[model samples]
Target: GGAKYLFPGIAGPDIINFTHWLGALVTSMHTIGVKDTPTRRVIHRAADFLPIPLLCIAMVLKGHDLHGLYIGPHSEAFSAAADLSAQLNIITVDRPFNHVLSMPSTMYDDLWTAAKAMYKTEPAIADGGEVIIFAPHITEVSYTHGRLIDQVGYHVKDYFLKQWDRFKDIPGSILAHSTHVKGSGTYDLATNTETPRIQVTLATSIPAERCRRINLGYLDYRDINPQTWQGREQEGILVVPHAGEILYRAKNLSNTATKGPHRSISGGASTS
Candidate 1:
């Protein structure tokens, strides 16, 4: 909905430094009453023009205008659907939990979609807590970017930011993917220590050795039974079924533990 998409979308993963930095700069400018800058115009035009050539070719081949083809006939229906989606996915929790069992569905067949479990569950996890990606079917880190991910591994954003030169050669998308799965944390250059805000454990088909190499914890998927995790929110435990689709946020933004009644979704449940 905003300029954030311009970073990786139109800017592309290559030339990531300039694209990312510029995208942020443009967004800041828009926020500070400087909306009509030359740079912003250029980027907007570029974004608009990017697909025109291909779109034109398609229009010529098909001999039809594509205008209004994508928009639904009923705007009210679309708005109502959007509202329902938000209600279902953007859930608010009363407090952070100590342990979160994030169960990515079959749609998340690879680490690419499975990684979303961490992003979606991060807001509901306490500091020093653990989030287990419980997907026995997900055996690959990424079907397309597995090799690169294996090389750099998953780490907090600062781990790469503080040591930019060492990782500058890698693709930004890959680095972004790494951090998204790792969640948030800090890296101490002097101590050479990486302290993630929460521990991310992969209880998937991926091996323990590989998980260790990638700086993530590992547990055998067979050891976990989803039914056992149900109704345990009072004990600071959370079970999120079809985890990747929902965004869970604690009402207490401090990420601290609080006592409250728990809420249960149809398939997933959490402490509200």
Candidate 2:
């Protein structure tokens, strides 16, 4: 039994809001829960958007013993849902994001920096594999952290005083969320960009008989309940982690606003 804190940015007003369900004291309710029911699907779609992951957490908490179909970038939310679901019977698939991407093709500089930091500094994702999982060249990169790791969850709070563009743009596009158990609170980043909400559904449902037409190499399904998947129709997708490290060079770049080594980020959205 754990608590989930959904941020206001990602939580849309559908039927649940992050403040409502996640905000409520656990002492009050225990059944299938929703942090924000009336979630505005508009901000729900962004891939890096965090609120949707909260939804996934809510789902697993309520339906830990269910057969679900999931997809998208797996982060703290994904890990939480998967663990909580506890083999409740779920299948996840991978697909290109259905919404406007935060990480655009034009963001080469930002992407390069994030890729380097992820491979170099972040031990959680870089340990077992090469420190730089992507590429030393940095034209493109991708990686997944199979192990549980910990990173400080400073979010908007730990930002250096100076608002330099170099350190942020990339990690901003991709999610910097941690799957570590200690990461439960919110830390605001510099921007309050809107995201999208896309419900996960099977993009393609072809049976093994059609294997000749398809290459089942990418499919990775982890069964929760052996009873449900036995001779039954079920599928899972493979979602890897897109982890990165935050560059605090801005503080040194401009010290006027940069207070001290500890006083790095400022003017970030307030998160209590």
Candidate 3:
């Protein structure tokens, strides 16, 4: 119909949501410019793209499903947001350099402690080894997928190679992306067979299948606390909390004393 052609074209829910939000942003920008008839019409049209944001507001007003807390007052909302930020591995921390891994959660501490107890601690991770950072589905999307690298203040050597080839090529280090799977296993994808690996699980709810498929070595979130690192483990694997936010490097931390001023290591990785 002719009426359909008068407005933006939307394919589905996802597209509509993004377009609507974007439209709102564009409309906001329009407020700073001239307000003509066509501009007004565009602004009016963009106003309709508020379903998702409205839904989010409603959810927050009622209380988040994950925690079931309705922050009524503005101050309370700010407090809640701060607490939420910390939980998401985003927060303001004022501290000096230190060797101890100030892990965010008990789950992370247990896992790292166990791995350290089991594995032969390496003087420098760059000597040779792999680190597999894993998290739950939500965390994977929010933090682990790729955002965690920025929060940790490390630059990817080759952005194009990593994006196109799916390999994080940090110098003297084998950084691997974690995949969500039903079972557990490690796959040797490299030509060389002597790469060390670390498996860090971020509070996953998957069954312990052990490293069966891809042999990067395996560490289960469940296996921590209850069980210490089994016998003698190979390499060093650490499952950090807020996997998207924290990428621990021995050299970086060990040399933090000589480094520049510290910055707060918190915030969500921008998907953009």
Candidate 4:
């Protein structure tokens, strides 16, 4: 649920903070399942802060005979979904790569959706690494939020945190989008310097000048060929085809390996 609906009439930083808290609460529910006293307590506390009517409706629906609830820390369908997610979304790499070529599909028509390429690939990248988002079709940073994004540019979370007064007027969601694309890093208060953990480059229709202005590196899409990047994982260069949907992680950090039969790719080989 969106903040506008869940936290109706509320605006600015407080709502954003509450939304973040709600997300964390929901994620915690996933670990222990939702059909328990702890989950009910959390929801009850949240209801006090939110509209009581919505909670009343939810409570009424909980006992509805038409509804089929899968309250689970474990269930057959849940296990199957988990297994499928591992096969499709989780790609395990032997080590972090210095360079990654992320290829977004046609669904990513603009930078807003295309940003997933960075999100999905960040965990597999080494410090000071570069992720080249290769999408010839993407010509705008964000169709809905381009002007706001242009004014802010992309930066680490600390950039906004250390200098909150300068950016406090901007919407929290836009600030979040800016930081996520920039990836993790540090910002120095004394020197007013920001250093991102990874360099995000664009190989797209968006111009080099605009890319630079937005604090992103640009490469002419025509100059590169996807074929050259294929089958070169050993060189610390990764090519992820259909990039945005899958998540790439270093093997050491992954809790569960991908199981069952699957076809092999250059950087991601299925782990038993």
- Candidate 4 at residue 146, lDDT? 97
lDDT of 4: 0.65
Clashes of 2: 38
The true-versus-predicted C-alpha distance at residue 252 of model 1, in Å, is: 2.7
Selected candidate, larger lDDT, 2 vs 4: 4
- Structure candidate 1, residue pairs in collision: 94-272
Candidate 3 lDDT over residue span 1-272, tens digit each:
11112233433444333433333233221221122334335433553554532111111121224533434432243345434433532222222121111124324332222222112121222222223333322122222223432222121222212343544333111121221110112233343222122222223332233232222233443333322322212323232333323222243312111212221111211010
Q: What are the RMSDs of all candidates, in order? A: 9.2, 20.4, 16.1, 9.9
Per-prediction TM-score, please?
Answer: 0.70, 0.19, 0.24, 0.68
lDDT (C-alpha, whole model) for all candidates? 0.65, 0.23, 0.27, 0.65
lDDT of 2: 0.23
Could you tell which candidate, 1 or 2, scores higher by lDDT?
1
Candidate 4 clashes between residue pairs 3 or more apart in a chain or in different chains: none
Structural RMSD, model 4: 9.9
TM-score, candidate number 1: 0.70
- Off-target runs (Cα >4 Å) in candidate 4 are 1-88, 252-272
Candidate 2: tens digits of C-alpha lDDT, residues 137-245: 2221223321111122212212311333533332322223211111112223557421111111111122222211211111111212223323311221111223221
